[model samples]
Target chain A: MATSTTRLPRAVDPNTVNGWGVDADPRNDPTYPFRDRSREDGPGMAWQRPPLQEPRVEVLRSIEHSRLPAVVGTSTPPKGLSGMIRRAAFRYSESDWRHWLMLLGADRINVVEGIFEDLARGRIPNIPAEMGARAEWRHNKLGLVRKVAIVAAVSAVAVALLRRRGRDDW
Target chain B: MLAAEYRGPYRMRAGRKRMPRIEHPRDALVRVTRSCICGSDLHLYRGMVPDTRVGMVFGHEFCGIVEEVGPEVEKLKPGDHVLVPFNIACGQCHFCKQGLFGNCHEANAEATAVGGIFGYSHTAGGYDGGQAEYARVPYADVGPTVIPDWMDLDDAVMLTDVVPTGYQAAEMGGIQKGDTVVVFGAGPVGIMAARCAWLFGAGRVIVIDHLHYRLDFARRYCPAEVYDFREIEDMAVFVKKQTDSLGADVCIDAVGGDAAGSALHTLFGKAMKLEAGSAIALHWAINSVKKGGIVSIVGVYGPTGNMIPIGNVLNKGITIRANQASVKRLLPRLIEHVQAGRIDPKALITHRMSLEDVSDGYHIFSAKLDGCIKPVLYPNGGQ
Candidate 1:
């Protein structure tokens, strides 16, 4: 088992962080002094509207909204096979089960794509390590052995049936 | 009005937004004073949560002063300082009547799972969050509680989510006297869960996380036994060894979907977008707990299935209790706990930035930068 010998980052100094004690001063605290309610009375829903944010990335909008809300998430824009499925999913209303189910299906496909991508990169993905199988084997050795045996037996039977079918065709 | 905008995964910006108004008769427009970047918000920020449209304001934990009240508003008037519950529940619903405010039926009629949540995505009922200067709070008479005279503003905001959620995590555990409780993920909720476990009569508390800073913070704040899961070769075995090879009585999954430690779970759950988030912590929790023990989950996962070890759960006879914390239901007892100084919710807050720096706040919190345990935003400018 390869243990992480890399040193973890040391704990940060609170004093060095920005905005560490912004509320420490009693004079600065709006609710301080316990008796004063003066700051609470100063503003009452009056303010200048912020400018609209220009969308830098293709933002996915729900069919329910007439227009886009004031802001949207731009991160992880649709890409790959999963992205195509996500784009299709967005075509339907969110309230529809198809929309959600398609997204779930896309997620599973995305995993397979990721494994293929890993393989394409000349990286042999450690299936057991990734799946925490080593720990599973250590903690539940009997269960792991039973599961492997069942899977092996099923594979052998399926292979034997296919071979028998080929022989019968000949 | 200035507000934090969700630009995309790993992105946030302090942008200009329209000031909110009372759209419903039960609505109260609140001028947000203090808001927080909750750990759950990271799921939405990471684009792991479904229906999290762009342009949504992301904040569920906040406190403010009521600026205007609609005609039907009776319990609260303008100029009242209040802490808002994260769950946007309509108090009249059957679930609410039963004190299950997190599952309020009418709040998010589109979903069968969770009630409406502020600053969460449309799946949580498209309510703009209080990360802005002003927010329209519906069911005004039901959710917002007046901040007590003696409570600090910082402490009041913590009650909105972290404290209550953590307390409820322990409450859901069915923790008994001298039971060894192990909590996974040392985020604020996990830290609070570990702290609250003591309140629930747990004999021992242990918190697991990969971050050194967080583990250090958990040691000081939760004051519980802390370990880096990275250093431990096998988490379940380590946990069992700690518990005299009998396993812990209660295990809490505070990490939820974004849990690390398994390359496979990270690939399938996070990077590949297969499951809501990683179920590694949950798997460990189920595997680490003693037979007939309880596994309490407060960590937020998408309303989808994960690769959970249900077989182990059934074989071990583990009682699994999970939910979005019924914040309103837990608030009363939590308020008392806060007031009594049994828990210092404010000590957990390490960063306080103005609403303009909210993007930085989210960045700091998300990256776990500058040793930030909790980051609060002053939307209407500090205090």
Candidate 2:
């Protein structure tokens, strides 16, 4: 009943949102969920045969000997989609584009990281009991840290401006 | 050193909830009084175990106090200080009784088809790990070890892993009263392998590692000759130069990855006397033998494959034997050596730590992995 007459803040124009960037629904807008396509088969079945021993033999052959050393000690800084694009450009070739590679790496790892965070948090959302039962998990690299940082920084800025006006209103 | 929980590659978070308690009736609750982050643990850390759920208590090498026991568990009681054998062997199994505990059907069945472990993958049978406040010890009578109150938990912890593993390597090495042996990879296990080689009567023990720290230890602590691989490029050329260009009587690839393998070629490149990868002692035993020589493997292998040529393996006419070390059988002897001061797997213990300092423990050690050989953790120092 209190919702009957409550005033709402005006919505931001889509053209002006986040510096006029395209508002793509990252979770489901066609290119979302990061499907490999090579692995899709109806719904649930994603697990391959599990290793029978300690040294997991076949971990992504394409990511051979050198790929491991690629992101050994990394930390990412968030700068939005444009920032991510810029970082990827830089990593591929030397130019004003180098920063793009960092963004790309961050963006790529972040998408994977977000879905993975729940598992990292030990939520154990309806999986084979044995999956969560093991002793180790992967690590969060610089990318997720960057995204979280950007979110924090944006919120902090928004709060600061509202405070400057000396009003509780946004 | 750092046994943080992981979700997959790049999804590590600080665990907030206290890890779960022993849930099953057959479980034996053992607080991880002493544990270490194993090299194998990194695979899970790297996200190889897909479906890897979060909140994994990561660690396996440990010695602990019996905090609680399952209702059916009559062999152990509280206050008993013990070492957890890396694999949970069901003493009732055929292979377990025959000393092939690693392949015991029940033991392997319980661990990701490979059986239960302290802190390992679902493949090892999804038992929760010991890296946290506690672990659920399955097949209790068979895997939980009994150590004395006087023994340092650090030394006892090796019985859970490298001590037996190293001794098993020597036993597989099949050394007579006197023989020449060369072991690759001076990581803690390699050093221990060399030490055990000396104990097994290797007239000449040569250890190979790129790290100066480990080779220096080998030179100073053990009687084995040391070969710092950083100085050498070719395995055959380097090893041969060391043994009058004849190659070692037994060559052990304590080194993982490219130690003996050339992945680019999908075959063995320059021939070395012995080979070891998925099975370090076994490769050495099989290929690096003296026509009738024995090779023993005690290294760790996950799902990775060793591109060994089986025909050549047979043609070599050598003795090859490797498996998960029979930890229970080897522990008592390893303890006697530790007690007798004949060997100090403890000296291999370069990092001494407590649970609170795990971050530093994981880092400094993880940073210089090959350099920071063995680290021992103690949760409760009371004992």
Candidate 3:
């Protein structure tokens, strides 16, 4: 692996920040805590918008990144590929997501270790372009697999639809 | 990193809230000079993403001056004016070490679990972004691109996301010398992708979008031929004709989210296609490629749910690469270019307003008013 590259030379830690507290501000007037009261028709209560979220990054830093052990039996919102594969829009299988994780060489343990190490010592890339090249290759490789799967799925659905249409005509 | 968060889903108030701060010792506080609005910010406003807190400051693409540094910081100084990469990475992590800052474990850890961004959500690590009087930037020394005194922060800010993202798209799409590359979207990112594609030495870069204004923008700004996907049919054929009857060697879906990806799904259908959307770009990426060609995805994906067909990838010899746009990868060189006046991303800006007029600017951008492309906010300009 190359030493680290410096796309940004003066990045900082956000964790030590404070006072950006719009949290319960008088700015919201009657609805102090919640902002964006456009939908203020919630009857007596303020209809505030929720915060933008993407906790997958934090989860990836956890011990159980790829394997979700059910978050203490309540099913933990079904994280990782298992949960995502269930969505109809994505059209991917569980194994596919797993394969992608591996293909990208991303693992929970490694991710955690890498983050700490990078923080411990500022990281710089020796072959920065190569890194992008690798992602390009990975995305391309995964895209190929996804296309094939979608084609097969769509083909099956098309054939079934045709059969159902024929039966209906009968 | 303390993100000067733009809390969407919630009406944004014009003020700086520095609630979130750096937890690690390596963090630094940044005095932001310039920040730009991202198209993705619209998603949060529309509530497509869930649970985004209202107090989140909303700047993602920005460049600034380092006001303070951590004890462990080695590469930066307090006075250095720098561009902050959208994703904050420590630069030495396996992914960071590998130059994939988009997937930087520390940067997107929380968001990956929930699929989100700065001021976007707790799922996205809830980092403070640089849309304020002061932004505490994370991974300070690693990702900041020092803007030479001669360089403009407005132009330098492009190094944060759009420009690098655009270049990453071209690289992912496998643009080769003299190859035709089709970018599906003429939004700022799409335009940047075209610009980057041309920069990568591609021949006849083509861009597609529904907006005439944006298409016209691409025709005027990008080095590629432009097409209107809304008015056209048989896109593959049209693109192929541009490539001497050969399909585009590379396809980039700079369009993001389910809507954009779904539009692509309907257009390409089940045929051989390629994509570069948010989470769903990988789905059609393979189908659009020319046999062994490539698809490049640069848009940011939401939390963990992504489904792509894998079997065809095995059959068709196509490859799909994605652009996380490693900031560290481009910082030095991008800074050099900016100082040299070779690239100026600020050309995308068409609207400029004070921090107080952000609501009006947002309205203009939201309505696509008067060919509004990129809107620059000057928080310090007026009372």
Candidate 4:
């Protein structure tokens, strides 16, 4: 690892940045204008906490939080291979890159799982439509064509190699 | 109440939702007049942000009329027209006192990093956004600013996020007199950043993007030099050549996550999902800046890490500054700028649709169709 000395910039004049002192006028201050300073020392967020929403589905909690927040998103709970990967990811600290990388990887895996699930349910998945390829074709025709060609070429080669391997096995 | 709900990736619908009530003493309910589909909102619509639940309303940029207010709210009253800042900050927090309202400790207390954001998903404290007929704004005294009589309602809505974010992008650059500033991505924020760089005394401003219409728009709007990155072979080389081989003094990575350029980044980040989003713009910024330049990032990235060129940052001795723009801190100045006609935030609005057609709005904006730069939604009706 290349360890470098951290160099802090000299104290900058507040005026150096544009619009730095533009809010100096008390009258123009949006949040608090001419408010008594005494209120600053008082307790913040004094409102009573609302009733927590029932977690109808599995809510993934980060390792950093001691408990689930008062409100948590319950949509698309962990399931399938992607869900397992996500569950494993939650085990690690969110600060760790592995945790995030795992989740991102799970997202892609989830897409594939979704397609498989759709096929299993006797519904032909519109991969192009789902991937927003129609819009891509309209807006970025050349780029979309290039991407499709690449995928086609790669798939063709992969299929040919698989067939050769089957003949060798026989 | 009808609100734009997230069904899944690339899916949105204007659906009937429960009317929001002031749950907290400091909360206020606002009848949304005009809301916008921000570039950052596409991240959630595209299923990039974590914990984006189905049926969650997704909007953070809105201007509205206050329908009701809790007893504790002092600054705003019922029937007041206000532009709500995206960040839901408690005024008394340590960060908020320092004017870093985007990192308020009291709001979004569960996770470390980023304050509460309305309609930005669970990752942003799960506060339902203003894409609805009415939205419950927490910390009413701290965030929403009464729209001045002189300001257009469209302009006030943009200030909630885009204008301030773009301004902060340039501000973070610490641009000195006649310094060369290069901004990546010609989206609304990028165009605004390019324009704001001139405000900070930048001699030359350059914008980079793949889209022709957006580049043309940036050229006309920012009146800065624009380049189609698709035409350029190497972004770093092109930037260096433009700046007499010294490189730009400041490079702003206004494009984050969904940036397309490098095949390696696309393969790993988007296809295989090894990283959060493609850090191509960030890479270009780091590589294209001068040895001791500043790379300011106002672009939205996933909470997780991305593949970055930290080694180049160390070797080049670059100063990297990034954050969710503290909208509250910049609001007063921004309001004045809009009033003075220095920055016309409303000019960016190229498409306007009723809230019922939010799905189509999302499609047009996301697809980059009909030369759509910024699409605004009127929940009640157009003014």
Chain A accuracy of model 2 expressed as TM-score = 0.19
Q: TM-score, each model?
A: 0.73, 0.64, 0.64, 0.78
Top-DockQ structure, candidate number: 4
Question: What's the count of clashing pairs in each model shown?
Answer: 14, 52, 120, 0
What's the candidate order when arranged by decreasing lDDT? 4, 1, 3, 2
- Clashes by residue pair, model 4: none
> What docking class should model 2 receive?
incorrect
lDDT by residue (tens digit), candidate 2, A31-81: 211334553443432223211222222221111122211101001222345
Q: Could you tell me the lDDT of residue B126 within candidate 2?
A: 43
Candidate 3 local lDDT, B1-383, one digit each (tens): 22232333223445434343444456676777777777766655443443333445667777767778867677888888877887766554344444556655444432234322344443354555556766666666666767767766678777788777776676565455555667877788889887766555554567877678888878766655776765665565665445455466778878766334355453432121222124344454445556666777665554334446667667766666655666667667556555655456889988776555555555456545668788777554411
Residue B123, model 4: lDDT of 63
The CA lDDT at A105 in model 1 is 63
lDDT of 3 at B178: 50
Tens digit of per-residue lDDT, candidate 2, span B18-71: 544444444577866778756556445544332233445567788778888867
- Interface C-alpha RMSD after superposing true interface residues, each candidate, one decimal: 16.0, 30.4, 24.3, 9.2
Q: Which stretches of candidate 1 lie over 4 Å from their true place?
A: A1-98, A101-170
lDDT of each: 0.75, 0.52, 0.54, 0.78
Candidate 2 lDDT at A153 equals 100
Q: Quote fnat for model 1.
A: 0.00
Error of 3 at A51 (Å): 28
Say which candidate scores most in lDDT: 4
lDDT of 1 by residue, A62-106 (tens): 565454433232323456787687778877775666777676666
